[model samples]
Target: MNYEFLRCDIENKVATVTISHSPGNKLNTQVYQEITQIMGELEANEHVNAIVITGEGEEAFVAGADINELADLDTVGMMDLTQITRTSYSKIENLNKPVIASINGEARGGGLELALSCDLRIASEYAQFAFPEINLGVIPGGGGTQRIQKVVGQGTAKELLYFGETIDAERAYQLQIVNKVVDQNELSSTAKEWARKLAQKAPVALRMMKLAVNTGANVDLESALTIEATSYDGSFATQDRKEGIAARLENRKPNFKGR
Candidate 1:
């Protein structure tokens, strides 16, 4: 399907969604709508086993929300805006297939929030990450505060959000916000390499693993174990599991059809 604000390219079961609001690539309401629709299609596409998200230009993965559009909201309006943004971002996290962020350049405020929404983040050497909402007399309205806290811990999260500082890609990797950092020229290829590797794994097992990590975080110890048990059972029933073991026995690489 053709998308105006984003581009969708699927190759070998890995779908790459590129945010294309050029120049700074700011997220406006139209951009949000496109992102929501694109994610829905990627989730429903049976051939897509993994996904990568990035920006269109070298200047930004996303700079932030369109400040001109965002600066007019009142308290109630801001609340409503936050809810929609949260819902859209949660859709990516809860997708059955993994979604990776290949951050090509500057990611600030909502841009960083968008990156955090993905299951994994890979940044270009030239990428810059910041949460500058605090400097604007505001804070991250998307799931940024919550998700960043979860991944990088409360103390580190507080420092980044409160200070509104721009850190390099290497610094982000040290904070564990970015999983990998590569040369700007190699960023897309590297992210695709990782996504293709993920696509080669058992799809059912990958989904269950995502559920365990995402859902179990909020549960009690026993409840978490129960969640894991269900996930294990779900994967065990798939043909991929039988094939995985059979291939191991024969000392051959498993052919996973993502069934």
Candidate 2:
């Protein structure tokens, strides 16, 4: 599908999605709709084993939501907008393939929330992060409150959300919000490298592992264990699992057909 607010490219089973709504990449309802469609396409594309999301330019991954659009939103409109964005974010979170947020620059408010939904985040040295919705007389509406706490601690999430404070890449790395912080020049290469590595893994195992972790996170320990066991058992039935075992025995690389 043609997209005005986003650009997508796929190579070697890795799909890179770049938000280009504006220089700051501030998201709006239209962007969320586009994201939902893009995600659906990626999910159906068997060749796409991993995904990477980032901003178009170096100035900002996404500064926040478009204030102009927010200014016009009434209570009902806000709720609708929130639902749309939340659904889009949830799609990224629940995708069987791993989604990596390549934070090329500042990611604040909704921008930060988008990154939080990803399975992993790799930020550049120049990148910054914040949950500044409080300053706007609103709070994060796109699963940020939950995901951030999962990535960082509850205390840290509260402090950041309550104060609307911004942190640089170093502090974000220390807080465990980002998986890696690299020089700006290396940001794209690093993110792609990670995606490519994931793409080469046993596809069925990758999907099942993601399902186990995400589905188990909200359940009791015993239930979570059961979920993992179920996923593990299902993986054993895949042809890739047999190939993986055979390759290990032969000391050769496995060519998983994503079965």
Candidate 3:
């Protein structure tokens, strides 16, 4: 399907989705709808093993939500918009395939929330991050309040949220908000390299791993252990597991068909 606010390119089992909305690539209702649609398409496409999300230009990965749109939203309209945005971000977080956020530039408010939804984040040295919603007289209406604390701990999350300060890529990396930070020119290639490596792994195992971790993180220790055990058992039943073992013994690369 075609998208007015997104540019998608698939190659080598990695689908890179670029947010193309101009003037900071701000997220809007239309963008959220397209995101939900594209994610479903990618999930059903067997050839796509991994996904990458980025913005169209270097100036901003996604500056934030469209302020103009927000200005017109009433309480009910805001709630509706929040639900749409939350659903789209949740789809990214819960997708069976791995997703990497290639943060090329400023990722503020909803943009940071979008990045947080991804499985991993690789930011360019030029990239900046913040949750500046407080300045707008509202807190982050997206999943930021929950996901940020999970990644960076409660104290740091609160500090960032309360202060609404912008952080450089190095500072973000130090806070463990981003997995890696590379030179501006290397951002795209680095993200693609990570996605390609992930795509080469056993598909069933990858899915199980993601499921176990995402599910386990929010559960008790005992429940988390059970989830891991179940995921392990499920992976063991796959043909890809057998192929992996055999390839190791034969000293050859495993050819996983995602079975």
Global local distance difference test of model 1: 0.91
- lDDT tens digits by residue: candidate 1, 88-158: 78888899999999999999999999999899999999999999989889878888889899988999999
RMSD of each: 1.3, 0.7, 0.6
lDDT of each: 0.91, 0.94, 0.97
Better of 1 and 3 by lDDT: 3
Model 2 TM-score, all chains together? 0.99
Clashes of each: 0, 0, 0
Model 2's number of clashes is: 0
Q: Give the TM-score of candidate 3.
A: 0.99
The better-scoring model by TM-score among 1 and 3 is: 3
Ranking by lDDT: 3, 2, 1
Hey, what RMSD does candidate 3 come out at? 0.6
Model 3 per-residue lDDT tens digits across residues 23-110: 9999999999999999999999999999999999899999999999999999999999999999999999999999999999999999
| Per-residue C-alpha lDDT of model 2 across residues 12-33, encoded as one tens digit per residue | 9999999997759999999999
Q: What TM-score fits each model?
A: 0.96, 0.99, 0.99
Clashing pairs in 2: none
